[model samples]
Target: MESPRVEMISNSFVKPKFISKEAKKPVYLSPWDLAMMSTHYIQKGLLYALPKNQDFSITAFLDDLKDSLSATLTHFHPLAARLSTVKQQNPPSFSVFIDPNNSPGARFIHSSVNLTVADILTPTDVPLVVQSFFDHHKAISHEGHELSLLSVQVTELVDGIFIGCSVNHMVADGSSFWHFFNSWSEVFRSNTISRPPVIKRWVPPGSDPIITLPFTREDQFIERPSPSCLRVRNFHFSSDSLVKLKAKANSECNTTKISTLQSLTALVWRCMTRARRLLPDQETSCRMAADNRKRLSPPLPETYFGTSLHSVKATATTGQLLDQSVGWAAWRLHQAVVNHDDKVIREFVNSWLKRPFVYTMSRYFDASCVHIGGSPRFDMYGNKFRLGKGLAVLSGYANKFDGKVTVYPGREGGGSIDLEICMLSKNMEAFESDMEFMSVVNEEDNKLRIF
Candidate 1:
């Protein structure tokens, strides 16, 4: 049970090759960015299989990756800069910009572990050793100025190489995080980046560019140790299951046909509520971050960098949610998602500016509330790293708590989806035993159960 241990071989910072004048100025944090200040740093990792025919040199590979990262940072300079507090203004403001003189280059770490790729992937649940692959595990996004905004770790496994990244949640969401990951892989494979990042921060016009929080101390945002025993498992919903679920939901709803994502969200939310054994009149809710790239009046580019999203939620009584058909639950969620338009987005941001509301872990700890994160649309397996086989696996880590859910694109690359769900250990057991939930996510085969 205690055989694998991670050995730190090296830890260093890799600075940008060059920084443009644009990056020297304060890259202000919008309301969306400030909203994530209290959350844990984003943890993402990618593993690639080592080819059988070649004898790889770990030293040579590390040198090559550092070189590529240096060039990558030249364009993604905000990631190389500090989290700044501008007290010179009437109301103190927070921004991230490269002082050039005081820049702490993005962290680069190299480590080795005595486990094979199979050892990490063969289990139904993530192995404890897997969390060690990432950096800044216990840190929060508020410490961005004090620490590396972006940290990467390369772990040498017995039969593969794992690249783990820790990005400040205040700096990027799931979309922007993958954008940087994709660009890095491109730079590593070829000396060119196809989609250069648009590093300029986005603040809705008329909205204040600079945001000051209600609290100033680091203790306010740091994650506290939880006594709850949480368990995480990724349930792969095959493309076929999605089709059937969507069809069933559409047939039940007369208003609008529910999307694949909505159908899946409904099923999960309903099942989770049922498993929690909430009271008939108990309040239950679920939220997902809506992408504003295309929803804004002057739409943003999908390639736009930084956080551009708003949290919208659906609420219902436990009785209402469970008594209704799956299609009814899906429509409730769909309405929340579709009704959140440009007006809704701007209004929510402005309201937050007036109040400076920050999310606390306690809010998601509610047994009746579920916070959905990430999207299946993200290209998880696209990090080829010059190998034709692409990535063996990629997963999120470090920020798990009760009721936190993340969705990922299935490795098979079809319409398939995977939900990385976490809950209190006892609740997780009950969730897995729910027959209705298992119908859409049956563990009848290893291909669906194991990655």
Candidate 2:
């Protein structure tokens, strides 16, 4: 299939409308923050269907969005800051901090595409469709000197507009990114801001001094993953199919009731492993990102704008995953989540403080591992953007790294899920034809017509 053509209209830098007096001061990065410094930027986007008869100037819309984004940064100051290290004489160690003065502000681009909303609504090459709407180079750039932690691109189409946002993973996680996004949209809609984030960094209890790991300057920036022939595809399961999956998963284990996420993760892990046809004794694992906000003692603030995530892994031999029932695999996944209590969260923090630079679960990037991203409960569809016509669809984009799967709420508004699966091209072909996989999924739900 031929790729759609997109024409760039303008590229410019957007600074904060109002800079805080404390903007020059440094903000410390927690242990959790350090872990994500080398990860790829988190990219999110939305398609808004404009009223057919309602004529509006695209230039006006772009100006309003840029102004509103600048206003939003006044509250999210760290996002408008550059990452740097602080050398302390007393400890003889350097700590990472966000330097506001050095930040040049977020990148903003205006572009136009010939593709209409209808062209992208179906199950086409999603990554290719969404890639043109985003600033792909800046999204994955590892050059720290750029100092632009956030970038936004507004692509105008004949029938609608696509708002694509990219944020440095080191500065924020999914929760934090959405928090900023919602706030910006609120500003754009009502000309007022919502709840400002709790900027105070959450530190682990106890007076033990922070051990600064020895990391070179290059380690501070993320190294782009090696290129590969990976393809990304989208699959949707209806609410009814999810219910049947849950029932099947629950019947395997009398003690635990598996949630939709666990069941789906188990199913996908099994299918991917089968499609890859790993050796019988090869070790396979599924890694998931768990939110530690409510699980922690006293709980972090709901608006804490930083990385409050922990990586949880469930491992089983390839043979076990392939031979076992979906329910059994789900039980294993459930156990992994249940074990990540307050103690585990604390232990993870402690471990990171000791050896802050070493990547956690780096082995999971191998072919035998599947990394689960996004959550069913994130309310992704709720982002209305106050555009009057409502949001047509919401999507996420990431580097097409193998073994990566992202889950989002189905557009049908029922208790369903949309899986964005990425793997080697050959593996994707095999996965598409897997009968067990096809039987569980609602094939009719594959095509989505948002209009």
Candidate 3:
């Protein structure tokens, strides 16, 4: 299929409306922050439906977004600054920081596409053109020096608009990403940020606060992974379906119950493994990101602005995952999430300080490994730029490879969730055909249509 064309309307930078005295100082990139140096930008799109009223002006709406975006950047100073790395003596270390004084601000692009809202939402799978809506879709976080760390593209559709944001992963994690998004929307509608971001960086005790990266360039850091023929599609899990799965998992397990997320994760993991047709003894694993904000001793503020993430993997043989009940798989996932506390986080940090090991996403350890990014916990539908209260459809671009699944809160809310799963064409076909998997997922919620 031919890719859709994206016509350039206009492109410009959106500088902060107000600069703080602190904006002059460089913000250090914590060891945790630099850990994401090799990953791709977090690209997401919030599709909004246009009201039938003729009074709404696209020109004024675009200006409003830029105005609010500019205001939002004042509180999120790092997004306005460039990531700068200092060259040091041979073979020792290098430091990175946000060059605050030279703020050029976030990149904003006003573009138009020949597609309607239905052209995107009605498809069974996300269109290739959707990738073009986001800037830096193929660029890594480490490349923020020459580019804007935050890029927003306002794409005009025949009957809708897509607010696509590409955020540098090295600068912030999923929590911070959504924090900035909600804050931006908050500023748009009300011109104020209710909860200000805590921009202070944190480091492990008895360790150098100024953590230097092990390498200078990305190639020196790690080799890039080759692009794969991956098919990304969404599977919506309704509240009712999730209740059944959770109840089933709970009935099969102990006094404690598994979370809705864990139950959903187990279903995807097991189904994907079966779809892959791996050997019974072949090892399969699921790696999930654990937020360490509340786990720390003097816990970082809930609004901490940098990456505070650690990967927790649950591994098992294909036979173990398949032969066992769905509850069994969920229990394994629950155990992994529960066990990743502050102690484990600290140990991981100390080990990194001793010898930095950037968990390269390119490395696929098990026979089949799945990495779950984003979280259902985020207020996906709450990002109301006042265009509407609910999302017509929410999706993302970039960093997608085989076995990558991003979890988003469903528009219906009330515990419903959406999983954007990526897999190779054949595997996805098998997965789609899987009776066990499809039988549980709500048929009505599976399509990428307007909520």
Candidate 4:
């Protein structure tokens, strides 16, 4: 062991410096983080529930998770590690910095996690512990930054377990989150870091000149709301069954416009419509997140660790929505993809310079106004790679959040999609029927798992 005299000398003379060569500088978040920024209260408290298998263990799971996150954390360059501070909360919020260390860019934030659900074996009260964790995390703030991204909570319930992660809105986006999760898992499975996450020059070229303003100059920063109610639900599916559903949707639409994702979106939209009994004339928006990394001139690297694309808001009337078959809805959904549109791209750029957070338009579609969520993602690559679950959440300002569903191909010549819907207890039945229909359509052809 080192002597206390030497330790004191080292402490007096040596200042710890962040080894960014091996680690990333903290990335800060800006008010203009996402393409479709929801108002604060509209998109904050999201929960996802996943069914637990008897074999899953909380201790082993957390150990693996910590190992994976800690390993991948080293890949970020100093600039990427820059954290952001926004002073609009009870405790100022902390965001992952989004601007390139050397260049001007919009600040975006999205975070990720790997969680497991195991049966509660001990008689201890888990919710109490969970509440404590929440309070502790909530109170923990990043030093000098207005946003904090390190809040994590774990709770053991009588039936299963829960993991809660609070992410600032200005650091990364959904696609970035996916890339991060995959990288974390890759390192965990291999027991070593994989290739560094790709972060090519993502900003498109030749924009009209505009002055760079501090975040305070922006019009709409997401305002934090008073504490509110939050809920979670979990679901799963096999890989093969989803393809069949997509095929059926394609046939019904009589066009190749239907993708597995679009078909599932149609199913989700229909169920949400039926459950809410929304009128056809009522304006409803199902904002589908489109990744724009490849749409730029110098396509952003898939592993680039910041918000890259603007969210495309697809608005449809309840009547027009209900009148369409799964195929038609899928086509409408496809037409909504506008990553290549120059006008939209310009707006995205301008959003960063203007106020009221350009992405805040999504607030108009909050739970009270429109349904502002989308279906899960399930691709063949997700399965062969064992990328854990492809769950997504749509939350920001409010106490409520939406779930993520993924489609996978099954071994028995079918495709399946797993859905985890979290809403009020009153809406549980509607959610079940939606899942049931999706399962029936896909499972009829093969095996399906709904967890």
How does each model score on TM-score?
0.93, 0.91, 0.96, 0.62
lDDT of 1 by residue, 1-451 (tens): 5957899999999988877787677677777787777778889877778766576677887898899999998888888876766543534433433334586689999999999878877777777787789998777787787888899999988888899999988888889999998888889988898888887777767765665665555565555545368777878788998899999998999654589999999999999998898999999998877898888888888888888877779999999999999999899889998898888877877787778756667754466888788898887788876544544445545568778888888777689887888888878888988888899994664343443
Model 1 ranges off by over 4 Å: 88-101, 214-227, 363-365, 388-397, 445-451
lDDT order of candidates, best first?
3, 1, 2, 4
RMSD for all candidates, in order, please. Answer: 2.3, 2.7, 1.6, 10.3
What would you estimate as the lDDT of candidate 4?
0.43
Q: So what's the TM-score on candidate 3?
A: 0.96
Error of 1 at 151 (Å): 0.5
Candidate 3, run of 10 with poorest lDDT: 358-367
Better of 2 and 4 by TM-score: 2
Best candidate (score: TM-score): 3
Model 3 pairs in collision = none
Q: Give lDDT tens digits, candidate 3, residues 60-116.
A: 988999999999999998998899878777776688787876657899999988888
lDDT of each: 0.80, 0.76, 0.83, 0.43
Sliding window of 10 residues with minimal summed lDDT for model 4: 6-15
For model 2 the TM-score comes to 0.91
What ranges in model 4 sit over 4 Å off? Answer: 1-18, 21-70, 77-148, 151-167, 189-191, 199-201, 204-220, 225-232, 235-241, 338-343, 351-362, 368-399, 402-415, 431-451
Model 2 Cα lDDT, one tens digit per residue, 37-135:
556678877887865556676777788898888898889988777777656665455656677875678889899888877777764556466777777
Q: Higher lDDT: candidate 2 or 3?
A: 3
lDDT over C-alpha atoms for residue 413 of model 4 = 27
